[model samples]
Target: MAEFKIVLSDRETGRSYKIDATGPAAGALIGRRIGEEIEGGVLGFAGYRIRITGASDRTGIPARRDLPGPARRRLLLSRGVGFHPVREGERRRKSVRGNEISADIVQVNAVVTQRGSKPLDEYFNRPEAAAE
Candidate 1:
């Protein structure tokens, strides 16, 4: 039973969540393409879904190049890419081991695609939920 640290970030909000997951389910997340959706319950939440956007190893180097500018900046900044913080909450800080995570630790970047009864509806009045 190995535990892997995962960081899930909300695209709309600049907030990131650190979830510690174990077992084969967490392992399956590796290599999944961006835009793929996963159950949020796996990260200990319900009524929510996560869409994978990017991932990185212990060193904080991105696994993909298509990440949005803000997302990339957040990841790098969390890994201490810039000057040291002068105060608390200066930059986005990850709760997981800072740059020293195990090789199996995959920091995942994701956005909440669904919450409660509402799926993220980009199209106004389309009501795509009925098709699901």
Candidate 2:
């Protein structure tokens, strides 16, 4: 899979996530920019309405203005116009505007749940994981 970095931010709260795309979703997410949106996961399952504070590459995912159908709808709902982050477990039950995420937006859910992980900036800067 293609590897790239992601720097996400909250326009309202000023929080951010500095992520390394290690899966198939890498190229599809690069260069999204702040206030821009993308969709992931499933409709009923866990999902996100992210504003791209920063993106690393620009080859895979195209701009929202170029998308069509449900893909566009998902983007427009989660990322378009006035978008924000959803809560951890509320999922489809709660709207993005009403829910709150844990800590800073830069701390991705996966990375945070790992046995022992540091802050995104520190983890990226450091060489190894520390003890929990």
Candidate 3:
């Protein structure tokens, strides 16, 4: 089964929570892409909604939204997700994963788009069986 370390960022609190997803929960994330919205119920957030922001593969390559598929590619870039230019008009070829989520992905980054009745602080503070 595919497993992923999910980091959920709360815009209001400016705080982030870490959760592990595996089995069915992990299965729900497959084929999802950056900038896509997902139901919170899939990740056990119930009423809350999550938006995919970014992801990293097992090899630590960051996924780019502009890319089309789930394969890694070396692209010449001016400035973007995986590459940061120091000088003016500087560009370099860098390896970045495609937007699509796959089993090779190790980490998933998201932001809460909708608020549930309960605050995330109270939710995360409660100890529960997190995916291992």
Q: Pick the candidate with the highest TM-score.
A: 3
What is the clash count of model 3?
0
Worst 10 residues of 3 by lDDT: 123-132
The lDDT leader among the candidates is: 3
**Range of the 10 consecutive residues with the lowest summed lDDT in candidate 2:** 94-103
lDDT assessment of candidate 2: 0.33
Residue 54 alpha-carbon offset, candidate 3, angstroms: 0.2
Best first by TM-score, ranked: 3, 1, 2
What TM-score would each prediction reach against the true structure?
0.49, 0.31, 0.92
Clashing pairs in 1: none
Which is superior by TM-score, 2 or 3?
3
Instruction: Report RMSD for candidate 3.
Output: 4.4
Error of 3 at 19 (Å): 0.6
The C-alpha stretches of model 1 lying farther than 4 A from their native spots are: 1-3, 11-14, 65-105, 117-132
lDDT at residue 112 of model 3 (Cα atoms): 97
Tell me how far the alpha carbon of residue 17 in candidate 1 is from the true structure, in angstroms, after superposition: 1.4
Q: Candidate 1 or 3, higher TM-score?
A: 3
lDDT tens digits by residue: candidate 3, 20-132: 99999999999999999999989888899999999999889999999989999999989989999999999999999999999999999999999988778777765442431
